[model samples]
Target: MTELDEPASAGPAVQLALRELGILLDKRVWAPGSRLPGERALAGQLGVSRSSLRQALAMLESEGRVHASAQRGWYVTTSVVSEPPSILKSFTDNARERGLVPTGRVLHRRVRPAAYEESRRLRIAPAAEVLEIARVRGLDTVPVCFETTVLVRARAAGLESVDLTDRSLFATLEEVAGVRVLRSAYSAHADAADAEAARLLGIPVGSPVLVGEEITSDQEDTPVLLCRSVYRGDAYRFEATLHRSPD
Candidate 1:
C-alpha cells in the first residue's frame, strides 16, 4: 500500500510524519501560537492518512510541542521563556539569553500624583509626583507581558521624556537617571486575562495569565520603583531551585 494508505498503527508512517512536522516547526513555517491547517489538509500535505496524521499530532502534543484547542484545531505551542526566581533580570536580558529578540511598545506615560498605596510602596509622602510608564513587552514581536511602573519623579528625572519603545526600562533608568535597580521584592500569582490584557497580549479573554508585582530598591535600600506585570501563561515559565531545610 502507498504511504497515504498506511494504517494509524504503522509505526514507520507515524514516525515519518512526526519528523516532517518537527522540521516545519523548527523552520517556523507557522509562528508560535498559530493554528495549523485542518487535519485533512495536513494529512494530504504530509502524504499520510488522516489516522496517521492524528497519531503524529498526538505525539507532538505529548511532547508539549503543540496543543489542541477545543473546536479550534491544533496550535503550535509558544516557545517558553523562563526565569529563575532567584535571579533579578530585565525582560530584555532574559530574552536575549535565550536568543529571542525582546521588544516593547510604550502604552502610556505621564507624571501623576501617587495614590495612597503607591506612596506607601515607594515610601514617599502622599500625593508626591510619580512617573508612570506602561508598556507591552514581547519576544520576537509576539506579545508576552503587559507592565506598568511607578516611581517617585525625583528619582528618575527626565525619564518621562525618554523613548521607551523597544528599549529596556531598567537600562534606561541607569543610563538617564543613574538610578540602578540593586534589588527587588517580587511576588506572582495565577490570574485570568481581562479585556485590556487580552488585547495587548493577543490572547482570548479569560485565558490563563500570571500576575506579578515587584518593588525595587537602589543602593541605599530605598524603594525606587513599584511595578505590576501580567504575563501570558502559555509563553512564560518561572523556575526556582529548592533545598530541604536542615532537621
Candidate 2:
C-alpha cells in the first residue's frame, strides 16, 4: 500500500499529498495556466482521500502556485512577469529580457475622429483623426495583459496598414513612421476585471487586475500616444525603488 493510502493521521496524509503535488508542479507536469486533473483522479493517483488532496491544493493556492474556479476546477498559476518601474521598456523588450517569448494579437484597429476625452489625452484637437488599436499580449502562450493604444493619425502615416501581429508597436513606430517615444507618464491602480477585460485576458469577470494608463511623449515632449492596459493580478508584478526625499 502507498504511504498516502491510509495514514493513521490526517496531518501526514496532507503533508504527503502536498509534497507530491509540489513535485509535479516543480517538474512542470502541468504547464502554467493549464487546468489540473480533476480532484477525484488526482486524489486517486496520489492514493489520498479527496479531503486530503483539497487541503494540499489549498496550501498551494495560498502560495500562488495554483488557483481555483467556482465551477471549473483548479488551474496551475502562470509564472509571474516582473517589471521595474524605473526603466522604460516595451513589453516585448521586457519579456525578451526575461527569456520569455513575447506575442501580440491585435483585436481591434481603426481610424476614428478623436472625441473630447481622446483629444484631451492625446493633446490633439477635437474631431482630429486618430488611430486606435487594441491587442492581447502574452508570454509563452499565457495571456497576461489586454491593452489599447491611441495616437494622432498624422504622427504615423500609413500606420493603420501595418500588420501588428507578433510585432512591437515601438519598433513599428520607429521604422515606419520615424516617430520615437522617448518617455512616458504612467499610473496604475488595483481594479476588478470588467467583462471585456475578462474575455480578453481569459479570467473570470471581477477578478482582481492591475489597470494602468500611460501617455507617451516624443523627443520634443509632445504627447503622441495614450495607452491603457489591464494586467492579470496573478501573472504580473510591478517593482519600484523607493527613496526618501531630502529634508
Candidate 3:
C-alpha cells in the first residue's frame, strides 16, 4: 500500500493551532446544541492562549456550535457544516480557527518581466518586472484551488523576501512589506480543470472549475496582485446578501 505524505499542521499554539473541536463536533464529538467546556478551562486543557481559545470558540459560535447567553457563555450551534467562508472580516483566521486546514504549496515563485497581457491591464511599461507566485492550495487535505498570482515589483519592492507558507498573502503584503491591498475587481468563468489542476484537486481530468481573475490595487491605485485562481466548483459556493427594494 502506498502511504500518503503527511499534511502540514496549523503549527504550535492554542489560538492558532488546529483546534479540531469544531470538526470534531461536526463529526459528532458532541450533539447539536450541546454546551461545550468553558473558555478558561478549554484554554487550560488545550495549553493555549485565551485569545486563541476564544478564536476557536468564536468560530464555533459563527457556525452555531455554541451560543452565548448574557450572563452565560456559548453553546453548540449546529451539526452540519455551519462554518462560514474566510471572506468575512478576517476569513483566514476564521477558517483556521474552525479547524479547516488551509495549506499553500508553492509550485513556482519567481521574478519575471510583466507579460504583454499584464502590461495592458496594469498599464506598466512593457517588459516591466513583476513577481509571479503560483500555489496549489488545499482545504483539509483536499486540493481545491489553484492560485497564480502576479504583482508589480517596482511599486512594491522586496520580491521573494518573506515566507509564503505559514502566512496569509494579503497579510504579509500589508504587514511585512507595507503593501496594503485596497481595491479589487474579480471576474469568474466556467472552465475545465487541467491535468495539473486535477492532480491537485483530486478529481478526474477536465473537471469543472470556476476560473476567477482578480486585479488588486493598493491605496495609491498601484496594482498589487493580478491573480488567476481556479477553484473547484464541487468544493466551493459563492454567497452574497443582495438587498432588493420591494417593487
Candidate 4:
C-alpha cells in the first residue's frame, strides 16, 4: 500500500535554524526597538552559516517580524500598523487610538514669512506671515516622527501661546480660533533619515523613514496648514483599502 504523503518543507538544516530563530522571537528574547546581533555572532550562536541565518532573517522580515535599518542593523518592528485616521485628527488622538500615550516635544516655534514654496502650497501670497512650529512626537519613550507645520498667522492667532507639548493641535485650533480642519491631502515617500532627523528620532543616521508632505484645508477647502514630517520606518506600516469600479 502507498504511504500517506507528507508536506513539502525547507531543507532540514535551514529548517532547524529557522525553528530556533522563531523560538527566540516567540520568547521575546529581544525586545522591540532592540537591535539584533551581527550576522556572524547570530549565526555562530544558532549553529548556522551566515547565509542560512540571513535567509531566516529575510523570511522574518517578510512576515513583519523584523526590520532592517539602513547603515545600522536589524531590529524588531513594532506590530502596530501606523495607518492614519480616516477623519481629521491630531497626532495625540492618533496615538491614543492605537493604545499609546502620546507626547510631543516642541523643538521650535516662531513667526516666519512664507517662502515661495510654502506660499504656493498654502495658497497664500509670497512673504505672508505664518506661524512655524517644529515638534518631535512620540508614543511613550519611542520617538516616531519629527514634524514641522506652517499655519497662516491670521487664521492661527494666539497659537504661539498654546502649550503645544500637552495640547492637541486640532483641538486647540477649533477651540481657540474656531477653525476646523476638514481634510488633508498628502503624499508619502521612502527616505533615509538625515542627521537632524536621526538625532531627534534616536536612530542612527541614514535609518529608513517615511516622509510625508501634507496640505490641510478648512471646511471651505481653503488651505490652512502645510506640514512636513518624517516617521520612523521600522515602527510604522501604512495600509489602505482600495476598490476598483466596474470597467
Which consecutive 10 residues in model 2 have the weakest lDDT in total? 1-10
TM-score of each: 0.91, 0.84, 0.61, 0.75
Candidate 3, after superposition: displacement of residue 10 in Å? 44
Tell me the alpha-carbon RMSD of every candidate.
2.2, 3.2, 14.9, 6.2
State the lDDT of candidate 2 residue by residue for 153-175, as single tens digits: 99978689999987889889989
Sorted by lDDT (best first), the order is 1, 2, 4, 3
Residue 96 lDDT, candidate 1, scale 0-100: 92
1-247: candidate 4 lDDT, tens digit per residue? 1111222233554676788988998887886667889877887897766666777788888888887766677887653536654555677777888887787899999998999998998888999999999999877657888999999999888798988895678788888888899888877899998999999987888878999888999878888899998998776666555678999
| Candidate 1's TM-score | 0.91
Q: After superposition, how far is residue 31 of candidate 1 from its true place, in Å?
A: 1.0
CA lDDT scores, all candidates in order: 0.90, 0.88, 0.66, 0.80
Q: List clashing residue pairs in candidate 3.
A: 15-52, 64-77, 64-78, 65-76, 65-77, 66-75, 67-74, 67-75, 86-91
- Give the clashing pairs for model 2: none
Q: After superposition, how far is residue 56 of candidate 3 from its true place, in Å?
A: 31
In terms of lDDT, the poorest run of 10 residues in model 1 is 2-11
Q: Candidate 4 lDDT (Cα, whole model)?
A: 0.80
Report the candidate with higher lDDT, 1 versus 4. Answer: 1
lDDT of 3 by residue, 105-158 (tens): 778889989989898788798889898988877655556678898988776666
Cα lDDT tens digits for candidate 1, 1-247? 8755666798877887899999999999998877899998998898888889899999999999998877778888886777766888899999998898999999999998999999998999999999999999998988999999998899998798989999988899999989889898988899999999999998889888999899999888989999999998888888776789999
Q: Rank all candidate structures by their TM-score, best first, as comma-separated numbers.
A: 1, 2, 4, 3
